[model samples]
Target chain A: MPIPSEHQRPTRVTAKESAFTQLQQWIIDGTLQPGEKLNDIELAEALGVSRTPIRESLQLLEVQGFVKMYPGKATQVTEVDKESINDLLPPLAAMQALSTELAAPNLDENVIIELEETNNRFAKAVQKEDYFTALKIDEDFHQIIVDQAANKYIHSIVASLQTHVRRLFFHNSIILTEKSIDEHKDIIRLLTEGNGEKAASIMRENWLRAIDEFHSKKTD
Target chain B: MPIPSEHQRPTRVTAKESAFTQLQQWIIDGTLQPGEKLNDIELAEALGVSRTPIRESLQLLEVQGFVKMYPGKATQVTEVDKESINDLLPPLAAMQALSTELAAPNLDENVIIELEETNNRFAKAVQKEDYFTALKIDEDFHQIIVDQAANKYIHSIVASLQTHVRRLFFHNSIILTEKSIDEHKDIIRLLTEGNGEKAASIMRENWLRAIDEFHSKKTD
Candidate 1:
């Protein structure tokens, strides 16, 4: 409910929120690589805003572990550690399990068809070797499960945690992408058939497989 | 590595770090209640720092979901959202469970003894009905398990997540204090007896129990 006051400026651009969004996108897009320096004045000039909003954006980024700042130092983007990625799985599995549990009861024929469509899109994207497109579609497909769980709280956390998981897998080997696509196919098949337990179990294992892939890449 | 340039006479405090820590503590201590207004100028004055560090700290807090800053309006402390907390748990649980698994091999007798000491202190604190002391001891006990796991990365995420968990449980009920101590005793006893499987299982269950207690109080 705490709305920004700097509204109603007739300009096409709102500086602060734009800065925040841009910074966040840079993080998501890996434009600003991990451990990269974020200089305030320079960034302010680049973003065409005052140092205030840029600084604010950096602080927000820091909290998400995307940026690190210390006393008397410029903040830098940071990588999620491999071990942290490994450690990130079980809870994700738990939440996904919870989601599937909830979704199972609520999922109707329409929802199943919709998820199946997304999953098919993901499969086509994978076959075309468009990993990025596959990734987004895959996200959309899984999101239905979490969304249908009807717990906004759990879904939010899963959303955030899933970002790190995706980013990790994105940077790791290509094999994970293939494995993940295959896994998605099976999960969609199970969900479409209303095999809730199998769907949930596969979803959980999918994350574990991703975790293992992450570790193998880390040591490699 | 990008250190900021300092002005004349670097004050007794590292302005940025102090603001950061103070802002975080204020949230944790409930001095800045949920949905409270956080004026940069006023908060800067109160914390005895300039707007620069205060701004930086506010941004940091914002990223972690502690504060919400509007562009022109004053930043306000954030309200607790159950969805966000549920979102927070997967990474937390994953890290804790992973740490427990890792510590299974490395939890030596001496470390178990130290954990026992911490557990005993928790019990004594509980007997004296000092919830704050009990909380500290309980945190110490868990930290040992995380430390023994030898994965600093997972440890850090788990530690950060624990802060939010602490805030929720501390404000909501006394049950975590009591249940935590009782569970800590059991966990330590099992660890000492080298029942790693049971100890880890209990540790995982402890988180679930705490979360359930939080939900119960939240609904009430």
Candidate 2:
């Protein structure tokens, strides 16, 4: 029954896209609880669109595994399992690493300065224990490199995988730390030196470490 | 007008899915040429369904970059770009390498033998210069590792990217040769020995080589 509030909805190029993006974000951020049935009629009214775009958005959401559709029946948000981290991180790590490698040779002074400023804010947010702000900042730092990579396939794929990653963070209390802040420094230095291979390995490790942290948290 | 014949349509559990799969394949294989407008009514009749499912299928296809839809206007298949190889291969190579690494310690004798047999058939097909069969058999060979890796995210993502790769191959006449067969043998050997790092490197290189071939072919 929960849908994004009027003020919180995304503004997209089309009614369908706006609905899909808002629905996907709500599901990812836990605003829409898993296993909750989605009412297309209600969603359409809330999004200020007709049922047609809402139905089309749900079909796209089904394709992305955010929701499940049952013919002549209800649509429900898919359950979130911590174990999905195992399935999610490996591919995400590879894509992030490839993005960094591709971006390394191309990093300029302006981008390097931007990376440092973003990391400073990220480190401060982590220090303040404001993990939500910190995680968003982390995405901004990585976004610089992802933009530099300029490969549309990697761009979209990484964005999709990172949605699941953000969901995990929301559910499991954001596994980042001062250690990650230091790793970001190493990443920046490696990129500055144009040593793309080492930068890529660090970037891969930067993500791979999260899996280990997830296991340790699970056992605790 | 070039929709797949009824006999060639893919069967799915739902009408919407069947329409989606068949339409996607038609676009990928160039049965529906780029810039060609799609009519939902005709597609619905061709696939023996209602227009609703055809519309839904087109929505999904647009998200996958196979189509572009205009509100109150026609939908058309997107163009195939040989230059997409630059955007496609790096991320794909990374995922494929990670899949290989994840599968290495897990590869049993049965999978190894399957790889060997698949490679043998692939080599024979290449020798006969039947590149279509050769390319499909190549998919089977890597699919062994992909299955062994057991990562659903990677499986889905690699499948999506590889679809674009296949379209490029089809458009560019399948830029493969005998050298790829030898590399497949080496890939099989390294995977069998459980040397995951070396195996991953080879897997990455195996896909990366296609980029050079794409460039060389572009020049020609």
Top DockQ hit = 2
Give the per-residue lDDT digits (tens) of candidate 2, residues B1-220.
Answer: 7956677534338888889999988988889998899999999999999999899999889888899887766799999877888899998888889999999989899988899999999999999999888988988888889989999889988888888888877777756789988888888889877798898998999999989888887643
Predicted structure 2: clash tally: 0
User: For residues A48-164, could you state the per-residue lDDT of candidate 2 as single tens digits?
Assistant: 999998999888888788898887777999998888998898898888889999998788999999999999999999999998999899999888899999999999998888888
TM per prediction: 0.77, 0.90
Return the top candidate by lDDT: 2
Worst 10 residues of 1 chain B by lDDT: B168-177
Count steric clashes of candidate 1.
Answer: 4
Report how far residue B53 has shifted in candidate 2, in Å. 1.4
Residue B4 CA error for candidate 2 (Å)?
34
Weakest lDDT window of 10 consecutive positions for candidate 1 chain A: A168-177
